[model samples]
Target: MKCIERIKYPEFDFKEYKASEGRHSVHDYPAMLHYLLVNHLIKNYSSENSLIYDPFCGSGVSIVESLKLNRKAFGTDINPLALLIADVRASNFETDRIRDVLDRFNIEWNNLTPDIPEVKNISYWFKDYVIKDLGKIRTFLRTVKDNEIFKFLLVVFSQTVRDVSNNRKGEFKRYRLSEEKLKQFTPNVRKTFISLVEKYLKIVETDIIPFTDFKLFLQDVRVSIPIKNVDLIITSPPYGDSKTTVAYGQFSSFSFDWLKGLNPYGDGDLKLDSLCLGGKKIKEQKELPSGHLYDALKNIEKIDEKRALEVYSFFYDYYLSIKQVVKTLNDNANVCFVVGNRTVKGIRIEMDFITAEFFESFGLTLENIFVREIANKRMPLKNSPSNITGKTSNTMLNEYIVIMRN
Candidate 1:
């Protein structure tokens, strides 16, 4: 089947796609679109036993979809929190064992005292009581024996932190909630944890797949995969520099705080460009005809002369790393990358085209580009217009899925 022919599901609709049932339904991203894309790739280019891979498997959407369709799946991400999530979501757990562990955790969690003695960033976003309750749940998970069950519960707890905290209903900027709003819905931490766990258990029971093989990696995608040549690749690489697009680490810092051993601010983690206001190096870099972004010290009137050179050097080096991975693909194998364009310094950076150009150097031909609208993704703050580019729409309505073949 041709790519377009395979994707032509009679039931597909953008509004209904947003409301479709599955993991992506609760979170952001169109699950139907991903499902359609995955199905198309598998049917046209992959066998049932083909090794499917997602380099930026955020929350393991592709991995889960692959298993649901009975394919071998592998995924990688730089965020430890994301890695943990991907691990649990894609794992084929024994239902009975998962239920037993969750029940035990709940029992022990209730008996423990809600006292988080050493807090980090808790005071800034959560009330004292909420923090105490959250700490108690974390304390119990620390003692759980089954690593799979423990990690699954950890994601559930982490997911709830945003809702129970002072920042539940605010726009996707930083965690800035009013005191009155915080008091309105002071979610009992223990109660919320139990509810989330129950929901997860119910989902697992209903949707668990018993015979799928999956692996999760906490590493940058620019490196080589430990496995031999893969049969297929489907991923959405980070848009622009990590610093400028979104502060994924900062967004999920609260959960990382609870997962004590995990490092949210580790060295290899990408530093956000929004927070960098003014430094010398931001001025000197050459602006790509296609508005590729770079991390520079914020608040400079123009790009810093010295810093621009350094930032460009860093970007090219990263691109070379991605190039190495592309070169490792099996002959005639197919790769699909979900990416989008962005504006930098009031210029449109056609990332899709630039990425096509990059991959072509490795003998991969651009087959097709499909545009999907991501209307639900978090947008820029209303009051804060982008300093470099003045446009202020928050929704990422325009997206591109670039297909390539060796």
Candidate 2:
């Protein structure tokens, strides 16, 4: 209830800053947090060696930042690709072993008969020769015995998959290129993969440091129990279900398919978006705890009842995730939920206010909400929420960082 009356959202300049810079450039994660922002939050809210947690740690930005700052970090996500990317980022690798392995892989590449992966509609997304080249790389990776080395190679391969795919660039959703574009799109998959591997290797050689206390899990926060005594929680939760918002699963579908052998979520069922918050339909809708949410839901329902149900389901799941997260907080622990106020049927949902209310419902005190411009967050500028062509709405231009304490 306190700090709720004087709610002033101050704008911060995050446009000029880079989120996927330096070592963080290992992979291109959609809508990743700025490294500077996560660093500031971790340093300001917690002390050295304290336990930090991120329930929805996309690409493990918070995990990598926390480990670098000498904090013990824990992160979880439903996306298998997210876990793999996060694990690779937080891990320390030997440059000599990597270089030696590459040398060996190059020698074996010419003689190796690449078996194309059983990714559904593989040809649609990749050219015949390109598929063979990627398969060769995956085949080479099987010879790798070192776990860290294998993970690093997987990250490189994942990036290569995205680059070579017919999926349109600069999009989180899966949209294949046009026939003309596909004909003109001839990507050197092998070169791209090697170049990326070397690029990340250079970064690892310089930025490699040991942080043994970090942990990354491929688990849903709503059901998984986080480690206790968490001193700080810094995360950017999904603004809405992946289908309506950023299709994270769609974005990683190719990578996930390539890495399916190691995928924790299993094979064939690549419904990452469906497994996300409010990804599925609910049997009944109930009034949530926040007044802001209630008003927004009513307004959206008036326009379209089905869309409102989807909205309600996402928040309900979000609330449940928050409940599990709150149980792990230590006394006086700090929490930061970076979120966006997305529009549905032209009705803006005040996610920041509702987030504050959810924390308050769980006996946490609201501190502040910092509004930052989405200078470089990789998201579409406009979306057709009504599903009507030419009827588009502007996505969130700013993100809200809601601070609270338990």
Candidate 3:
């Protein structure tokens, strides 16, 4: 087989890592870009000690690959669960230690009575017995003094909640089971939780954390970042509002609410789905320098004004976020935004073109745009162009890798 560093563009295929499962399933990123683009950006800096930062790290692919290369990685996300999953992914622990924690919990499992945590409309999301078992998991987790152990157990518990909740599997937004479907559905929460815990343990044994240090922050990139002078950035920003493009908030809500229910702000309390790029409104008086985004918005407005507003709002805040991230980069440092151009009301929103314009306005130079077919990404497969309710339309199948430099 050819050596990894020697593999070049067009020749490399995602089939090599088709087994991108397990913890990888915790969030979505183009598996190919995570491997290829990350390596490509690392090649920019000659020093092995260079810092790699991802503001919108999502599931932490950028950080993980940076560590694999023995580089110090720093990442932050507005979503706490994303940070938690990234923390679990980057966790440095021996298999024996994890197994011991679980074994100890199992021994004390009989003594602890199931106690449910408070959640908003708890009954609407879970069955009573499922709630009891979730409480059992939370109670046991609270007893573990080790932070690493606590985080790993939390991942298992969060996954368990998603699997057993009334929400349909794979749907981002919370949707209750139909009355007929509810009549027949039954999930054994305790058994499912234990099985998932064991499954994650096996994955832990095989994972190797080669890097020595990493810093993960729970903050919004649109507001502030804790670190500065980042050498490189590799991130996949949201395509549009969470409501239309991707329901990141919806996808993560079940797990987030459970974490919040256990403790108001200890785990998660942000309305992430609604707090993202297009989540809130921002006024934009100046016209975009490029005509593409402007034209698309006008067309969308003629047909669907609500969607037009969502797109406008997303770009307005997204522009500010890009401005903030650029300030943290060193002179001549490279930034790669792996993004998709999704359609709304049959008009394509050219994120690549728009991103390049934003970078230019900030006195940065556009390097190159690499187009690649997205591979090994799990999406709902179809989404409506004009509906926030999610209608059937052709989903995003390709992505643009827009690389820019200061």
lDDT of each: 0.59, 0.83, 0.72
Model 3: colliding residue pairs: 172-250, 384-391
Model 1 ranges with Cα > 4 A deviation? 1-13, 25-33, 114-117, 170-173, 262-318, 379-395
lDDT of 3 by residue, 176-253 (tens): 878888878799887787788777777766767678589888877788777898888888888887766656676776
Best of the candidates, TM-score = 2
Candidate 3 deviation (Cα RMSD): 4.9
Candidate 3: stretches off by over 4 Å: 1-16, 22-37, 40-47, 178-184, 261-266, 381-393
Candidate 1 lDDT over 150-265, as tens digits, reads 66777777777766767645333345676676657667777777677777666766777654798877765555556547778877765644345545655555555566563232
Clash count for candidate 2 is: 0
Q: Per-prediction TM-score, please?
A: 0.79, 0.94, 0.88
The order of the candidates by lDDT, greatest first, is: 2, 3, 1
Report the CA-based lDDT of candidate 2 relative to the real structure. Answer: 0.83
lDDT of 2 at 266: 40
Q: Quote the RMSD, in angstroms, for model 1.
A: 5.8
Candidate 1 lDDT at 405 equals 89
Model 2 / residue 353 / CA error / Å: 0.9
lDDT of 2 by residue, 254-370 (tens): 888888785433432458788889898886977667999999999999999998998899999999899899999999999999999988888999899999999999999998888
